[model samples]
Target: MPLYKTITPNSQTTVKIWKITESFDVLMEEVDLKPKSLERVLGMKSELHQRGFLSVRCLLKAFGYDDVDLHYDENGKPYLKDGKHISITHSFNFSAVIISDSKIGIDIEKQRSKISIIANKFIDYEFSYLDENALNYINKLTIIWCIKESLYKLFATPGLSFKQHCLVIPMSDNEQETVAWIDYEAQKSRYNIHFLEFEGFTCAYAIN
Candidate 1:
Protein backbone atom coordinates (compact mmCIF):
# COMPACT_ATOMS: atom_id res chain seq x y z
CA MET A 1 0.00 0.00 0.00
CA PRO A 2 2.09 2.83 -1.26
CA LEU A 3 -0.48 5.52 -0.47
CA TYR A 4 1.78 8.43 -1.26
CA LYS A 5 -0.38 11.16 0.24
CA THR A 6 -3.91 12.07 1.22
CA ILE A 7 -5.53 15.48 1.60
CA THR A 8 -8.88 16.63 2.84
CA PRO A 9 -9.17 19.78 0.75
CA ASN A 10 -12.52 20.52 2.33
CA SER A 11 -14.84 18.84 4.80
CA GLN A 12 -16.67 17.13 1.95
CA THR A 13 -13.83 16.38 -0.44
CA THR A 14 -11.03 13.81 -0.27
CA VAL A 15 -8.04 13.43 -2.51
CA LYS A 16 -5.80 10.36 -2.56
CA ILE A 17 -2.60 9.73 -4.46
CA TRP A 18 -0.82 6.40 -4.95
CA LYS A 19 2.78 5.78 -5.86
CA ILE A 20 2.73 2.68 -8.08
CA THR A 21 5.66 0.37 -7.30
CA GLU A 22 3.90 -2.96 -7.10
CA SER A 23 4.05 -5.63 -9.72
CA PHE A 24 0.89 -6.21 -11.73
CA ASP A 25 0.39 -9.52 -10.00
CA VAL A 26 0.87 -7.94 -6.61
CA LEU A 27 -1.75 -5.25 -7.31
CA MET A 28 -4.15 -7.77 -8.76
CA GLU A 29 -3.90 -9.83 -5.59
CA GLU A 30 -4.62 -6.82 -3.37
CA VAL A 31 -7.78 -5.58 -5.09
CA ASP A 32 -11.04 -7.29 -5.99
CA LEU A 33 -12.16 -5.73 -9.21
CA LYS A 34 -15.60 -5.69 -10.73
CA PRO A 35 -16.00 -7.82 -13.85
CA LYS A 36 -15.82 -4.86 -16.20
CA SER A 37 -12.72 -3.55 -14.56
CA LEU A 38 -11.15 -6.98 -14.76
CA GLU A 39 -11.96 -7.16 -18.41
CA ARG A 40 -10.66 -3.66 -19.00
CA VAL A 41 -7.42 -4.47 -17.27
CA LEU A 42 -6.99 -7.68 -19.20
CA GLY A 43 -7.53 -5.82 -22.42
CA MET A 44 -4.84 -3.24 -21.76
CA LYS A 45 -1.76 -4.12 -23.82
CA SER A 46 0.73 -2.11 -21.84
CA GLU A 47 1.73 -3.43 -18.45
CA LEU A 48 2.14 0.12 -17.22
CA HIS A 49 -1.47 0.91 -18.11
CA GLN A 50 -2.58 -2.32 -16.50
CA ARG A 51 -0.78 -1.36 -13.31
CA GLY A 52 -2.24 2.14 -13.44
CA PHE A 53 -5.72 0.67 -13.69
CA LEU A 54 -5.15 -1.61 -10.75
CA SER A 55 -3.60 1.20 -8.71
CA VAL A 56 -6.83 3.16 -9.12
CA ARG A 57 -8.67 0.34 -7.46
CA CYS A 58 -6.11 0.52 -4.68
CA LEU A 59 -6.85 4.23 -4.28
CA LEU A 60 -10.57 3.49 -4.21
CA LYS A 61 -10.07 1.03 -1.39
CA ALA A 62 -8.15 3.65 0.53
CA PHE A 63 -11.07 6.03 -0.02
CA GLY A 64 -13.55 3.52 1.48
CA TYR A 65 -14.95 2.44 -1.87
CA ASP A 66 -14.13 -0.24 -4.44
CA ASP A 67 -14.40 -0.94 -8.12
CA VAL A 68 -18.06 -1.84 -7.72
CA ASP A 69 -18.86 1.65 -6.47
CA LEU A 70 -17.55 3.37 -9.58
CA HIS A 71 -18.94 3.79 -13.07
CA TYR A 72 -18.55 6.00 -16.10
CA ASP A 73 -20.93 8.14 -18.07
CA GLU A 74 -21.41 8.38 -21.82
CA ASN A 75 -18.76 11.08 -21.84
CA GLY A 76 -16.35 8.75 -20.02
CA LYS A 77 -16.39 10.86 -16.85
CA PRO A 78 -16.27 8.83 -13.66
CA TYR A 79 -19.05 8.84 -11.08
CA LEU A 80 -19.66 7.47 -7.64
CA LYS A 81 -22.68 5.32 -6.85
CA ASP A 82 -23.20 7.10 -3.54
CA GLY A 83 -23.98 10.35 -5.38
CA LYS A 84 -20.65 11.97 -4.55
CA HIS A 85 -18.77 13.63 -7.41
CA ILE A 86 -15.63 11.78 -8.52
CA SER A 87 -12.73 12.36 -10.89
CA ILE A 88 -9.63 10.24 -11.58
CA THR A 89 -6.21 10.61 -13.18
CA HIS A 90 -3.05 8.54 -13.61
CA SER A 91 0.31 9.18 -15.22
CA PHE A 92 3.48 7.14 -15.25
CA ASN A 93 3.98 5.95 -11.66
CA PHE A 94 1.23 8.06 -10.08
CA SER A 95 -2.56 7.87 -9.84
CA ALA A 96 -5.08 10.04 -7.98
CA VAL A 97 -8.73 10.47 -7.23
CA ILE A 98 -10.85 13.36 -5.93
CA ILE A 99 -14.32 12.88 -4.52
CA SER A 100 -16.54 15.67 -3.25
CA ASP A 101 -20.11 16.49 -2.40
CA SER A 102 -20.05 19.08 -5.14
CA LYS A 103 -19.07 18.53 -8.74
CA ILE A 104 -15.34 18.10 -9.03
CA GLY A 105 -12.51 16.95 -11.32
CA ILE A 106 -8.92 15.88 -10.86
CA ASP A 107 -5.82 15.28 -12.99
CA ILE A 108 -2.21 14.24 -12.42
CA GLU A 109 0.49 14.66 -15.04
CA LYS A 110 4.19 13.93 -15.21
CA GLN A 111 6.31 17.01 -15.78
CA ARG A 112 7.86 16.68 -19.19
CA SER A 113 9.45 19.01 -21.68
CA LYS A 114 7.37 17.40 -24.46
CA ILE A 115 4.40 19.40 -23.18
CA SER A 116 6.03 22.46 -24.74
CA ILE A 117 5.62 20.99 -28.21
CA ILE A 118 1.86 20.75 -27.83
CA ALA A 119 1.40 23.82 -25.67
CA ASN A 120 -0.14 25.76 -28.51
CA LYS A 121 -2.94 23.29 -28.91
CA PHE A 122 -4.14 23.60 -25.32
CA ILE A 123 -3.06 27.09 -24.30
CA ASP A 124 -4.52 30.38 -25.44
CA TYR A 125 -5.15 33.14 -22.92
CA GLU A 126 -2.52 31.67 -20.60
CA PHE A 127 0.31 32.38 -23.03
CA SER A 128 0.26 36.03 -22.10
CA TYR A 129 1.39 35.28 -18.54
CA LEU A 130 3.83 32.45 -19.25
CA ASP A 131 7.52 33.03 -19.85
CA GLU A 132 8.84 30.40 -22.24
CA ASN A 133 12.43 31.23 -21.26
CA ALA A 134 11.89 30.68 -17.55
CA LEU A 135 13.50 27.71 -15.84
CA ASN A 136 10.11 26.56 -14.56
CA TYR A 137 8.50 26.77 -17.97
CA ILE A 138 7.86 23.01 -18.11
CA ASN A 139 6.45 23.04 -14.60
CA LYS A 140 4.11 25.90 -15.42
CA LEU A 141 2.98 24.21 -18.62
CA THR A 142 2.28 20.98 -16.75
CA ILE A 143 0.06 22.84 -14.28
CA ILE A 144 -1.92 24.48 -17.07
CA TRP A 145 -2.34 21.15 -18.82
CA CYS A 146 -3.53 19.49 -15.67
CA ILE A 147 -5.89 22.40 -14.99
CA LYS A 148 -7.49 22.14 -18.40
CA GLU A 149 -7.71 18.37 -18.18
CA SER A 150 -9.41 18.57 -14.80
CA LEU A 151 -11.83 21.16 -16.14
CA TYR A 152 -12.57 18.95 -19.09
CA LYS A 153 -13.35 16.03 -16.82
CA LEU A 154 -15.66 18.26 -14.76
CA PHE A 155 -17.42 19.82 -17.73
CA ALA A 156 -17.65 16.42 -19.53
CA THR A 157 -18.99 18.25 -22.51
CA PRO A 158 -18.16 17.05 -25.98
CA GLY A 159 -16.41 19.40 -28.41
CA LEU A 160 -15.06 21.57 -25.60
CA SER A 161 -11.82 23.10 -26.79
CA PHE A 162 -9.12 23.53 -24.15
CA LYS A 163 -7.43 26.33 -26.06
CA GLN A 164 -10.58 28.31 -26.83
CA HIS A 165 -13.01 27.51 -24.04
CA CYS A 166 -11.02 26.88 -20.86
CA LEU A 167 -9.12 29.83 -19.40
CA VAL A 168 -6.84 29.39 -16.36
CA ILE A 169 -6.22 32.57 -14.44
CA PRO A 170 -2.61 33.56 -14.03
CA MET A 171 -0.90 32.59 -10.77
CA SER A 172 2.63 32.42 -9.44
CA ASP A 173 4.43 29.16 -8.74
CA ASN A 174 4.01 29.77 -5.01
CA GLU A 175 0.23 29.99 -5.29
CA GLN A 176 -1.56 26.93 -4.06
CA GLU A 177 -4.85 27.77 -5.74
CA THR A 178 -6.37 29.92 -8.46
CA VAL A 179 -9.50 30.17 -10.61
CA ALA A 180 -10.62 29.12 -14.06
CA TRP A 181 -13.61 29.61 -16.31
CA ILE A 182 -15.32 27.62 -19.03
CA ASP A 183 -17.01 29.60 -21.77
CA TYR A 184 -18.60 27.34 -24.28
CA GLU A 185 -21.71 27.53 -26.43
CA ALA A 186 -22.95 30.66 -24.67
CA GLN A 187 -22.82 28.89 -21.33
CA LYS A 188 -20.31 30.02 -18.72
CA SER A 189 -19.16 28.43 -15.48
CA ARG A 190 -16.37 28.99 -12.96
CA TYR A 191 -14.24 26.65 -10.88
CA ASN A 192 -11.81 26.92 -8.03
CA ILE A 193 -8.50 25.40 -9.12
CA HIS A 194 -6.08 23.87 -6.63
CA PHE A 195 -2.69 22.40 -7.54
CA LEU A 196 0.40 20.84 -6.05
CA GLU A 197 3.63 19.31 -7.31
CA PHE A 198 5.26 16.17 -5.98
CA GLU A 199 8.11 14.00 -7.27
CA GLY A 200 8.23 16.03 -10.49
CA PHE A 201 4.54 15.48 -11.15
CA THR A 202 1.74 18.03 -11.04
CA CYS A 203 -1.72 17.36 -9.65
CA ALA A 204 -4.62 19.75 -10.15
CA TYR A 205 -8.24 19.54 -9.17
CA ALA A 206 -11.26 21.69 -9.93
CA ILE A 207 -14.24 22.37 -7.68
CA ASN A 208 -17.40 23.92 -9.01
Candidate 2:
Protein backbone atom coordinates (compact mmCIF):
# COMPACT_ATOMS: atom_id res chain seq x y z
CA MET A 1 0.00 0.00 0.00
CA PRO A 2 2.07 2.89 -1.23
CA LEU A 3 -0.31 5.59 -0.05
CA TYR A 4 2.23 8.32 -0.53
CA LYS A 5 0.52 11.32 1.06
CA THR A 6 -2.80 12.56 2.38
CA ILE A 7 -3.98 16.10 3.04
CA THR A 8 -7.05 17.57 4.64
CA PRO A 9 -7.16 20.88 2.82
CA ASN A 10 -10.26 21.87 4.73
CA SER A 11 -12.79 20.32 7.04
CA GLN A 12 -14.92 19.44 4.03
CA THR A 13 -12.15 18.28 1.70
CA THR A 14 -9.75 15.32 1.54
CA VAL A 15 -6.96 14.64 -0.96
CA LYS A 16 -5.14 11.34 -1.31
CA ILE A 17 -2.15 10.39 -3.47
CA TRP A 18 -0.92 6.95 -4.40
CA LYS A 19 2.53 6.01 -5.62
CA ILE A 20 2.09 3.03 -7.92
CA THR A 21 4.60 0.24 -7.30
CA GLU A 22 2.54 -2.91 -7.24
CA SER A 23 2.21 -5.36 -10.08
CA PHE A 24 -1.04 -5.42 -12.05
CA ASP A 25 -1.92 -8.86 -10.73
CA VAL A 26 -1.36 -7.74 -7.15
CA LEU A 27 -3.48 -4.65 -7.56
CA MET A 28 -6.23 -6.66 -9.23
CA GLU A 29 -6.26 -9.11 -6.37
CA GLU A 30 -6.40 -6.38 -3.75
CA VAL A 31 -9.29 -4.29 -5.06
CA ASP A 32 -12.78 -5.63 -5.71
CA LEU A 33 -14.03 -3.65 -8.70
CA LYS A 34 -17.52 -3.57 -10.10
CA PRO A 35 -18.13 -5.46 -13.33
CA LYS A 36 -17.99 -2.30 -15.39
CA SER A 37 -14.81 -1.14 -13.71
CA LEU A 38 -13.24 -4.55 -14.16
CA GLU A 39 -14.13 -4.47 -17.82
CA ARG A 40 -12.80 -0.95 -18.21
CA VAL A 41 -9.49 -1.83 -16.59
CA LEU A 42 -9.16 -4.96 -18.65
CA GLY A 43 -9.81 -2.99 -21.82
CA MET A 44 -7.04 -0.51 -21.13
CA LYS A 45 -4.29 -0.95 -23.71
CA SER A 46 -1.48 0.25 -21.50
CA GLU A 47 -0.46 -1.56 -18.36
CA LEU A 48 0.43 1.76 -16.77
CA HIS A 49 -3.12 2.99 -17.26
CA GLN A 50 -4.54 -0.20 -15.84
CA ARG A 51 -2.37 0.12 -12.77
CA GLY A 52 -3.35 3.74 -12.30
CA PHE A 53 -7.01 2.80 -12.58
CA LEU A 54 -6.62 0.06 -10.02
CA SER A 55 -4.58 2.30 -7.73
CA VAL A 56 -7.47 4.77 -7.66
CA ARG A 57 -9.69 1.98 -6.35
CA CYS A 58 -7.05 1.39 -3.71
CA LEU A 59 -7.25 5.04 -2.72
CA LEU A 60 -11.05 4.87 -2.62
CA LYS A 61 -10.75 1.99 -0.19
CA ALA A 62 -8.62 4.18 2.02
CA PHE A 63 -11.48 6.71 1.95
CA GLY A 64 -13.90 3.94 2.99
CA TYR A 65 -15.53 3.61 -0.43
CA ASP A 66 -15.33 1.07 -3.23
CA ASP A 67 -15.75 0.83 -7.01
CA VAL A 68 -19.51 0.39 -6.71
CA ASP A 69 -19.82 3.72 -4.96
CA LEU A 70 -18.36 5.63 -7.89
CA HIS A 71 -19.86 6.42 -11.24
CA TYR A 72 -19.38 8.80 -14.16
CA ASP A 73 -21.65 11.32 -15.76
CA GLU A 74 -22.34 11.90 -19.44
CA ASN A 75 -19.42 14.28 -19.44
CA GLY A 76 -17.18 11.52 -18.09
CA LYS A 77 -16.75 13.25 -14.76
CA PRO A 78 -16.69 10.97 -11.76
CA TYR A 79 -19.09 11.31 -8.84
CA LEU A 80 -19.85 9.58 -5.57
CA LYS A 81 -23.09 7.77 -4.86
CA ASP A 82 -23.34 9.55 -1.50
CA GLY A 83 -23.39 12.91 -3.34
CA LYS A 84 -19.99 14.23 -2.28
CA HIS A 85 -18.08 16.13 -4.99
CA ILE A 86 -15.18 14.09 -6.40
CA SER A 87 -12.39 14.56 -8.97
CA ILE A 88 -9.60 12.22 -9.96
CA THR A 89 -6.26 12.38 -11.81
CA HIS A 90 -3.41 10.08 -12.60
CA SER A 91 -0.08 10.48 -14.36
CA PHE A 92 2.59 7.95 -15.20
CA ASN A 93 3.38 6.75 -11.69
CA PHE A 94 0.98 8.67 -9.45
CA SER A 95 -2.77 8.99 -9.00
CA ALA A 96 -4.83 11.33 -6.82
CA VAL A 97 -8.36 12.05 -5.72
CA ILE A 98 -10.01 15.07 -4.13
CA ILE A 99 -13.38 14.88 -2.47
CA SER A 100 -15.19 17.82 -0.93
CA ASP A 101 -18.57 18.91 0.25
CA SER A 102 -18.42 21.69 -2.30
CA LYS A 103 -17.74 21.27 -6.00
CA ILE A 104 -14.11 20.46 -6.62
CA GLY A 105 -11.63 19.21 -9.23
CA ILE A 106 -8.13 17.72 -9.21
CA ASP A 107 -5.32 17.01 -11.70
CA ILE A 108 -1.86 15.44 -11.56
CA GLU A 109 0.77 15.95 -14.28
CA LYS A 110 4.36 15.03 -14.82
CA GLN A 111 6.65 18.06 -15.13
CA ARG A 112 8.42 18.03 -18.46
CA SER A 113 9.80 20.39 -21.07
CA LYS A 114 7.20 19.15 -23.55
CA ILE A 115 4.60 21.26 -21.83
CA SER A 116 6.40 24.32 -23.10
CA ILE A 117 5.73 23.24 -26.65
CA ILE A 118 1.98 23.28 -26.11
CA ALA A 119 2.00 26.28 -23.79
CA ASN A 120 0.55 28.64 -26.35
CA LYS A 121 -2.46 26.46 -26.93
CA PHE A 122 -3.69 26.58 -23.35
CA ILE A 123 -2.20 29.81 -22.06
CA ASP A 124 -3.36 33.34 -22.73
CA TYR A 125 -3.57 35.82 -19.86
CA GLU A 126 -1.01 33.74 -17.99
CA PHE A 127 1.61 34.35 -20.67
CA SER A 128 1.92 37.95 -19.62
CA TYR A 129 3.14 36.93 -16.18
CA LEU A 130 5.20 33.91 -17.20
CA ASP A 131 8.86 34.58 -17.73
CA GLU A 132 10.20 32.26 -20.37
CA ASN A 133 13.81 32.96 -19.32
CA ALA A 134 13.18 31.96 -15.73
CA LEU A 135 14.87 28.91 -14.28
CA ASN A 136 11.55 27.32 -13.32
CA TYR A 137 9.74 28.00 -16.55
CA ILE A 138 8.65 24.42 -16.95
CA ASN A 139 7.55 24.29 -13.35
CA LYS A 140 5.50 27.44 -13.68
CA LEU A 141 3.87 26.22 -16.88
CA THR A 142 3.09 22.90 -15.25
CA ILE A 143 1.28 24.64 -12.39
CA ILE A 144 -0.74 26.76 -14.78
CA TRP A 145 -1.64 23.73 -16.90
CA CYS A 146 -2.64 21.75 -13.85
CA ILE A 147 -4.73 24.63 -12.55
CA LYS A 148 -6.60 24.96 -15.82
CA GLU A 149 -7.15 21.19 -15.99
CA SER A 150 -8.61 21.19 -12.50
CA LEU A 151 -10.90 24.04 -13.43
CA TYR A 152 -12.02 22.10 -16.52
CA LYS A 153 -12.86 19.09 -14.39
CA LEU A 154 -14.73 21.28 -11.96
CA PHE A 155 -16.82 22.91 -14.63
CA ALA A 156 -17.30 19.75 -16.69
CA THR A 157 -18.75 21.88 -19.46
CA PRO A 158 -18.47 21.19 -23.15
CA GLY A 159 -16.55 23.46 -25.54
CA LEU A 160 -14.72 25.18 -22.71
CA SER A 161 -11.48 26.51 -24.07
CA PHE A 162 -8.60 26.54 -21.62
CA LYS A 163 -6.95 29.46 -23.40
CA GLN A 164 -10.04 31.62 -23.59
CA HIS A 165 -12.22 30.52 -20.68
CA CYS A 166 -9.87 29.63 -17.80
CA LEU A 167 -7.59 32.25 -16.36
CA VAL A 168 -5.10 31.42 -13.60
CA ILE A 169 -3.96 34.35 -11.56
CA PRO A 170 -0.25 34.92 -11.47
CA MET A 171 1.67 33.60 -8.47
CA SER A 172 5.22 32.98 -7.50
CA ASP A 173 6.85 29.58 -7.25
CA ASN A 174 6.97 29.83 -3.46
CA GLU A 175 3.21 30.18 -3.29
CA GLN A 176 1.22 27.03 -2.65
CA GLU A 177 -2.15 28.53 -3.51
CA THR A 178 -3.76 31.11 -5.80
CA VAL A 179 -7.03 32.06 -7.42
CA ALA A 180 -8.55 31.31 -10.83
CA TRP A 181 -11.67 32.13 -12.77
CA ILE A 182 -13.80 30.48 -15.41
CA ASP A 183 -15.61 32.67 -17.88
CA TYR A 184 -17.59 30.66 -20.33
CA GLU A 185 -20.85 31.23 -22.21
CA ALA A 186 -21.64 34.39 -20.24
CA GLN A 187 -21.31 32.48 -16.96
CA LYS A 188 -18.53 33.12 -14.49
CA SER A 189 -17.25 31.49 -11.32
CA ARG A 190 -14.17 31.72 -9.13
CA TYR A 191 -12.18 29.07 -7.37
CA ASN A 192 -9.23 28.75 -5.04
CA ILE A 193 -6.34 26.85 -6.58
CA HIS A 194 -3.86 24.79 -4.57
CA PHE A 195 -0.82 22.98 -5.92
CA LEU A 196 2.04 20.73 -4.87
CA GLU A 197 5.12 19.32 -6.61
CA PHE A 198 6.93 16.09 -5.80
CA GLU A 199 9.28 13.72 -7.58
CA GLY A 200 9.07 15.63 -10.86
CA PHE A 201 5.28 15.64 -10.84
CA THR A 202 2.76 18.34 -10.01
CA CYS A 203 -0.75 18.09 -8.54
CA ALA A 204 -3.33 20.85 -8.46
CA TYR A 205 -6.86 21.02 -7.11
CA ALA A 206 -9.58 23.65 -7.27
CA ILE A 207 -12.51 24.34 -4.95
CA ASN A 208 -15.36 26.75 -5.38
Candidate 3:
Protein backbone atom coordinates (compact mmCIF):
# COMPACT_ATOMS: atom_id res chain seq x y z
CA MET A 1 0.00 0.00 0.00
CA PRO A 2 1.10 3.59 -0.48
CA LEU A 3 2.60 5.00 2.69
CA TYR A 4 -0.08 5.63 5.29
CA LYS A 5 0.98 9.27 5.27
CA THR A 6 3.67 11.50 3.79
CA ILE A 7 4.46 14.90 5.27
CA THR A 8 6.67 17.63 3.86
CA PRO A 9 7.27 20.31 6.44
CA ASN A 10 8.89 23.02 4.41
CA SER A 11 11.76 22.01 2.14
CA GLN A 12 13.87 20.41 4.84
CA THR A 13 11.85 17.71 6.57
CA THR A 14 9.88 14.71 5.33
CA VAL A 15 7.96 11.94 7.11
CA LYS A 16 6.39 8.65 6.06
CA ILE A 17 4.40 5.91 7.80
CA TRP A 18 3.50 2.31 7.14
CA LYS A 19 1.14 -0.22 8.65
CA ILE A 20 3.21 -3.16 9.92
CA THR A 21 2.41 -6.55 8.37
CA GLU A 22 4.00 -9.74 7.09
CA SER A 23 4.20 -8.08 3.70
CA PHE A 24 7.00 -5.87 5.01
CA ASP A 25 9.58 -8.23 3.54
CA VAL A 26 9.45 -6.22 0.31
CA LEU A 27 10.49 -3.17 2.24
CA MET A 28 13.04 -5.07 4.34
CA GLU A 29 15.06 -5.87 1.22
CA GLU A 30 15.79 -2.19 0.74
CA VAL A 31 18.10 -2.18 3.78
CA ASP A 32 21.77 -3.18 3.68
CA LEU A 33 22.21 -5.37 6.77
CA LYS A 34 25.77 -5.75 8.02
CA PRO A 35 26.67 -8.51 10.49
CA LYS A 36 26.56 -6.25 13.56
CA SER A 37 23.34 -4.61 12.47
CA LEU A 38 21.90 -8.02 11.69
CA GLU A 39 22.36 -9.09 15.27
CA ARG A 40 20.34 -6.12 16.49
CA VAL A 41 17.82 -6.68 13.73
CA LEU A 42 17.45 -10.34 14.67
CA GLY A 43 16.62 -9.47 18.27
CA MET A 44 13.41 -7.79 17.17
CA LYS A 45 10.45 -10.20 17.06
CA SER A 46 7.26 -8.31 16.33
CA GLU A 47 6.25 -6.82 13.02
CA LEU A 48 6.44 -3.39 14.61
CA HIS A 49 10.12 -3.74 15.39
CA GLN A 50 10.91 -5.02 11.92
CA ARG A 51 8.95 -2.26 10.29
CA GLY A 52 10.70 0.30 12.45
CA PHE A 53 14.02 -1.15 11.34
CA LEU A 54 12.89 -1.10 7.75
CA SER A 55 11.92 2.54 8.10
CA VAL A 56 15.45 3.48 9.08
CA ARG A 57 16.80 1.81 5.98
CA CYS A 58 14.05 3.17 3.76
CA LEU A 59 14.75 6.67 5.02
CA LEU A 60 18.43 6.37 4.24
CA LYS A 61 17.69 5.05 0.77
CA ALA A 62 15.33 7.96 0.21
CA PHE A 63 18.23 10.31 0.90
CA GLY A 64 20.75 8.24 -1.04
CA TYR A 65 22.54 7.08 2.13
CA ASP A 66 23.66 3.57 3.05
CA ASP A 67 22.06 1.92 6.07
CA VAL A 68 25.00 -0.42 6.81
CA ASP A 69 27.20 2.56 7.60
CA LEU A 70 24.75 4.03 10.13
CA HIS A 71 25.20 3.42 13.83
CA TYR A 72 23.61 4.21 17.18
CA ASP A 73 25.20 5.91 20.17
CA GLU A 74 25.17 4.76 23.78
CA ASN A 75 21.76 6.34 24.32
CA GLY A 76 20.45 4.18 21.45
CA LYS A 77 19.99 7.10 19.08
CA PRO A 78 20.66 6.58 15.40
CA TYR A 79 23.35 8.74 13.85
CA LEU A 80 24.12 9.18 10.21
CA LYS A 81 27.66 9.11 8.93
CA ASP A 82 27.04 12.24 6.88
CA GLY A 83 25.35 14.01 9.80
CA LYS A 84 21.76 13.77 8.70
CA HIS A 85 19.17 14.04 11.43
CA ILE A 86 16.96 10.97 11.75
CA SER A 87 14.44 9.60 14.22
CA ILE A 88 12.23 6.53 14.12
CA THR A 89 9.50 4.56 15.93
CA HIS A 90 7.13 1.62 15.65
CA SER A 91 4.14 0.32 17.59
CA PHE A 92 2.06 -2.75 16.93
CA ASN A 93 1.54 -2.80 13.17
CA PHE A 94 2.70 0.73 12.41
CA SER A 95 5.99 2.56 12.04
CA ALA A 96 7.19 6.06 11.09
CA VAL A 97 10.28 8.18 10.43
CA ILE A 98 11.25 11.84 10.41
CA ILE A 99 14.25 13.18 8.48
CA SER A 100 15.02 16.84 8.59
CA ASP A 101 17.50 19.65 8.11
CA SER A 102 17.85 19.64 11.88
CA LYS A 103 17.27 17.14 14.67
CA ILE A 104 13.84 15.55 14.51
CA GLY A 105 11.79 12.80 16.16
CA ILE A 106 8.87 10.58 15.17
CA ASP A 107 6.72 8.06 17.07
CA ILE A 108 3.74 5.83 16.31
CA GLU A 109 1.48 4.11 18.84
CA LYS A 110 -1.43 1.72 18.61
CA GLN A 111 -4.48 3.20 20.26
CA ARG A 112 -5.09 1.31 23.48
CA SER A 113 -7.71 1.58 26.21
CA LYS A 114 -5.03 1.09 28.85
CA ILE A 115 -3.56 4.53 28.13
CA SER A 116 -6.26 6.01 30.39
CA ILE A 117 -5.04 3.97 33.34
CA ILE A 118 -1.80 5.92 33.45
CA ALA A 119 -3.02 9.26 32.17
CA ASN A 120 -2.30 11.11 35.38
CA LYS A 121 1.20 9.72 35.42
CA PHE A 122 2.03 11.38 32.09
CA ILE A 123 -0.46 14.23 31.79
CA ASP A 124 0.09 17.11 34.15
CA TYR A 125 -3.02 19.06 33.18
CA GLU A 126 -6.45 17.54 33.03
CA PHE A 127 -7.22 18.26 29.39
CA SER A 128 -10.02 20.78 29.81
CA TYR A 129 -11.39 19.79 26.43
CA LEU A 130 -11.94 16.20 27.51
CA ASP A 131 -15.45 15.73 28.79
CA GLU A 132 -15.43 14.83 32.46
CA ASN A 133 -18.18 12.31 31.82
CA ALA A 134 -16.24 10.67 28.99
CA LEU A 135 -12.91 9.55 30.36
CA ASN A 136 -12.14 6.71 28.00
CA TYR A 137 -11.58 8.00 24.51
CA ILE A 138 -8.84 5.77 23.14
CA ASN A 139 -7.83 8.29 20.49
CA LYS A 140 -7.12 11.13 22.91
CA LEU A 141 -4.97 9.05 25.21
CA THR A 142 -3.07 7.70 22.22
CA ILE A 143 -2.38 11.24 21.09
CA ILE A 144 -0.96 12.08 24.52
CA TRP A 145 1.21 9.00 24.56
CA CYS A 146 2.47 9.68 21.05
CA ILE A 147 3.24 13.29 21.93
CA LYS A 148 5.31 12.29 24.94
CA GLU A 149 7.14 9.65 22.97
CA SER A 150 7.95 12.05 20.14
CA LEU A 151 9.33 14.46 22.70
CA TYR A 152 11.50 11.78 24.29
CA LYS A 153 12.93 10.84 20.92
CA LEU A 154 13.64 14.45 20.12
CA PHE A 155 15.41 15.18 23.38
CA ALA A 156 17.12 11.78 23.69
CA THR A 157 17.36 12.44 27.39
CA PRO A 158 16.20 9.30 29.17
CA GLY A 159 15.36 10.51 32.66
CA LEU A 160 13.08 13.27 31.44
CA SER A 161 9.53 13.00 32.83
CA PHE A 162 6.67 13.40 30.41
CA LYS A 163 4.12 14.58 32.98
CA GLN A 164 6.19 17.10 34.89
CA HIS A 165 8.30 18.41 32.00
CA CYS A 166 6.89 17.80 28.55
CA LEU A 167 3.50 19.37 27.85
CA VAL A 168 1.09 19.58 24.92
CA ILE A 169 -1.56 22.13 23.94
CA PRO A 170 -4.24 20.16 22.21
CA MET A 171 -6.07 21.58 19.21
CA SER A 172 -8.41 18.63 18.64
CA ASP A 173 -8.99 15.03 19.71
CA ASN A 174 -8.69 12.92 16.58
CA GLU A 175 -6.72 15.55 14.67
CA GLN A 176 -4.51 18.11 16.34
CA GLU A 177 -1.10 19.78 16.52
CA THR A 178 0.39 20.41 19.96
CA VAL A 179 3.42 22.34 21.19
CA ALA A 180 6.08 20.43 23.18
CA TRP A 181 8.79 21.96 25.30
CA ILE A 182 11.58 20.98 27.69
CA ASP A 183 13.31 23.09 30.30
CA TYR A 184 16.63 22.07 31.74
CA GLU A 185 18.91 24.23 33.83
CA ALA A 186 18.51 27.78 32.49
CA GLN A 187 17.67 26.82 28.93
CA LYS A 188 14.33 25.96 27.36
CA SER A 189 13.37 25.08 23.80
CA ARG A 190 10.03 24.30 22.27
CA TYR A 191 9.04 22.25 19.24
CA ASN A 192 6.02 22.12 17.00
CA ILE A 193 4.17 18.85 17.56
CA HIS A 194 2.05 17.30 14.80
CA PHE A 195 -0.24 14.26 14.92
CA LEU A 196 -2.12 12.00 12.53
CA GLU A 197 -4.09 8.77 12.87
CA PHE A 198 -4.39 5.85 10.47
CA GLU A 199 -5.02 2.12 10.52
CA GLY A 200 -5.90 2.12 14.24
CA PHE A 201 -2.66 3.89 15.12
CA THR A 202 -1.56 7.33 16.23
CA CYS A 203 1.57 8.91 14.71
CA ALA A 204 3.25 11.96 16.18
CA TYR A 205 6.20 14.05 14.98
CA ALA A 206 8.31 16.77 16.59
CA ILE A 207 10.60 19.25 14.81
CA ASN A 208 12.62 22.15 16.23
Top TM-score hit: 2
lDDT of 2: 0.95
lDDT of all predictions: 0.94, 0.95, 0.74
10 residues in a row with least lDDT, candidate 3: 126-135
For model 3, which pairs clash? 20-93
RMSD of each: 0.8, 0.7, 2.5
Q: Across residues 130-191, which tens digit of lDDT does each residue of candidate 1 receive?
A: 99999999999999999999999999889999999999999777888999999999999999
Give the TM-scores of the predictions, in the order they appear.
Answer: 0.98, 0.99, 0.86
Ordered list by TM-score, greatest first: 2, 1, 3
lDDT of 1 at 85: 95
lDDT tens readout by residue for model 3, 23-69:
55777676777787777777877755766677656655665677675
Scored by lDDT, the top model is: 2
The candidate, 1 or 2, that scores higher on lDDT is 2
Q: Please report how far candidate 3 places residue 26 from its true position, in Å.
A: 4.6
Error (Å) of candidate 1 at residue 70 is 0.9
